[model samples]
Structure formats: C-alpha cells, structure tokens
Target: MTHASCEPARITEPDLIAIRDDLASREPIFHRPEWGSTRADFERMIAEGFWETGASGRRYSRAFVLDELERRYASPPLDDDWESCDFHCQRLAADIYLLTYSLRQGARETRRSTIWQRAGSDWKIVFHQGTIVQDA
Candidate 1:
C-alpha cells in the first residue's frame, strides 16, 4: 500500500508578530476606498503573499483580497475613517500569539483579536477573530 508523507508543521510566535506588523502597516493604504488609491497597493500586497480565509472556509489569497476590495469599492461607502488603532499581544508561545487590536473613529470603536502563527521567515497569518466593544 502506498501512503502520502505528512508535511511538517512550522509555526511560531515571532512569526505572528511580524505578520501583525505587516498587516498593520497596510491599514493606511486600505483605508482609502477609491480604486485609484488602492489598486496598486492591493496588487503589491498580493505580490508580498498575504492571504486569509472567508466565511465559507475558502482560502482567499492576496488576489482575493484585491478582488474583494474592488467589489467593496464598487458598492456604497462603508465607513473608512479610523481615528486610532492599537495592537496587543495577549498570549505568545514560541511563534504563536493571541493578538488584539482596538480601532476607533470619531464616536465609534471596535476591538478585534486573532491567533497568528508563523508560516516561515515571512510570517503568514493563520487565524482571526474579532468583536466590537463599547468605548471605555
């Protein structure tokens, strides 16, 4: 009988931090809803290899991110002002971290958290979870 070899797992906390930094760096670029403002930015993100999953459990690569951004831009405005954003590494182990970010814009604010693991030296994102919180 033939069997398939298992792929080794290589995830870490420092990796998660790097990914967070990379994503956070893009906030300013993504905040711009105009296609002209974001097209090249989104393309660059894809070239750099950022990826995420959708509610349907389908893997969304950097190309998908750009496509979705375009789709959103085609629709009515969906709030694009962020007064501030904060990130905290709640839990860390080797190359994994439970990260939380609180974002605020004018009178509205929300907090989002995610579990990130390193994929390699590049630090690919693994998971994300978010929630809204009342302003303190």
Candidate 2:
C-alpha cells in the first residue's frame, strides 16, 4: 500500500497543530537528547504496558526496550542524523492520539506510528511500531 493510505484521518486544525507541535519534536523517540535521553527519562515517558514492533517486525516489551535503550545510551555514540516527514495525527480518543510519519536514517527508510496519551501538558507513549519502506 502507498504511504498515503497510512494516514487515515485528520484531526481538527487546532489540535492538529498543537499535537504536531507537541509530538513532532519528541519523535524518532529516544533520539532527542534535548528531551532527556536518560533511562529514567525514558521510563517516565513510556506507559506501563508500552510495546513496540520494530522495523524488523519483531515485537519488543517495555522492559526489553527500556533496558536496551539504557545500555545503548550509557556510552552515547556520535549523534545519529535522521529526518522525518509525512506527518499525520488522528485523534483516537480524548487525549489519545495516533501519530504517523516516515523516517529516514541514512539509506534506511521506515514508516513509523506512535500512540500517545496526553496527561495534562505531558505525554506518554502507549504503543509504537515501525515498518521498513521498501525501495521502488
């Protein structure tokens, strides 16, 4: 299916802007050092039952993902250069949003989706997944 089909709905204009603003900067999750890259920070931002399907199609549990992230960041490597675009936000329920975007890291391109729940002004990720975008 084309990337366009992935974006199924559009939120209201105002919420669209606010959600895009609130979420865009925090995405490609765990990559934004400005938002705190520590394990504790990661823990705080993730829901208790957080799970993810990696671009490789394997599901990862909350503890596994968190531990791996902590290990990877313990001695942070050179900053990764990635770009994300084709953003779309759909309101799933009150204060819950599904954000979809495409991410490029060097030669690898992937479609990403994150389910986030808003808690006042802060947000926590409930679920996330990524699928590799095949070359034409």
Candidate 3:
C-alpha cells in the first residue's frame, strides 16, 4: 500500500487577521467587482512605483500591468473564478505590510506575496510577486 500526506498550510498570524482579512478580500488583485472595475479605479489602488514578478519570473512595471489590465477588463473573461488561501501577514514598517498566500485558478496554482502601504484608511499596492508551485 502507498500512503500520501502533506504538511498543513500556514495560518494567518492572530495579530495580523484584521489587516490580512482586509487585504485578502482584494487580492488576486483585479477580480473583485465591488472593489472597482475600471482602470482609473485600479490606478488609484496601486502606488506610483508598483511592480510585480509573475509566476513566469517576468517583471512587470506599473504602466505595463495597468495597460494589460485595462485591455483584459474591456471584455472580461466569463470563467474568472479563482481561490486564495493560507494568508499570512507581517508588518514591514509603520502602516506597511507584507501579505503572502496561495492562489489557485482552475488547475493553476501559485504562491503570491504583496507589499502594501496604508495612507490614512486606504491601502496602496507597492509590490507583488507570484511563483508557480511545482508538483502541486
């Protein structure tokens, strides 16, 4: 007989639940319609210096990402379902935080991280990266 088991995913640190919940709801970034569906709206959520490293290991700049997002939003996909779990957050500085989680889109899965900075009551995206999980 063969048996298989996997270790448990990380739990969100109790101290960071409030911040983690707030950010998790908006993660996988442009998926939540309630958050905002327009490019201008997205532009407001990300910092001027925002950037990302895709699961492909390619770097994307603020302008490039926004432009690509604008194009995708023009005619949104019908099957846009994705799920995120195992969120964990840490304070990077005063009002700055780092959030990490696992994201699954259909069969594709990746580990994601985002840096956020809070200005007053609003959070702005600073940096984000997604690395493909092998043998998942």
The residue pairs that clash in candidate 2, if any, are none
Question: Which 10 residues in a row give candidate 2 its minimum summed lDDT?
Answer: 7-16
TM-score of each: 0.44, 0.88, 0.87
Ranked candidates (TM-score, high to low): 2, 3, 1
* Model 3 error, position 43 (Å): 0.8
Per-residue lDDT tens digits for candidate 1, residues 39-87, read 5645643334456543344666666677777777676657666754665
Cα distance off (Å), candidate 3, residue 95: 0.7
**lDDT for each candidate structure:** 0.53, 0.87, 0.87
lDDT of 1: 0.53
What is the TM-score of candidate 1? 0.44
lDDT of 2 by residue, 1-136 (tens): 8989996565446747778777988998888888877889999899998999998889999999999989988896577878998777888899988888899988889999999999877999999999998643
Show model 2 residue runs off by greater than 4 Å: 1-14
Error of 2 at 34 (Å): 1.0
Q: In lDDT terms, how accurate is model 2? A: 0.87
- Candidate 3: Cα lDDT at 75: 90
Error of 2 at 48 (Å): 0.4
- Per-residue lDDT tens digits for candidate 3, residues 5-68, read 4654556678889999999998878777788788998899999999999898999999999998
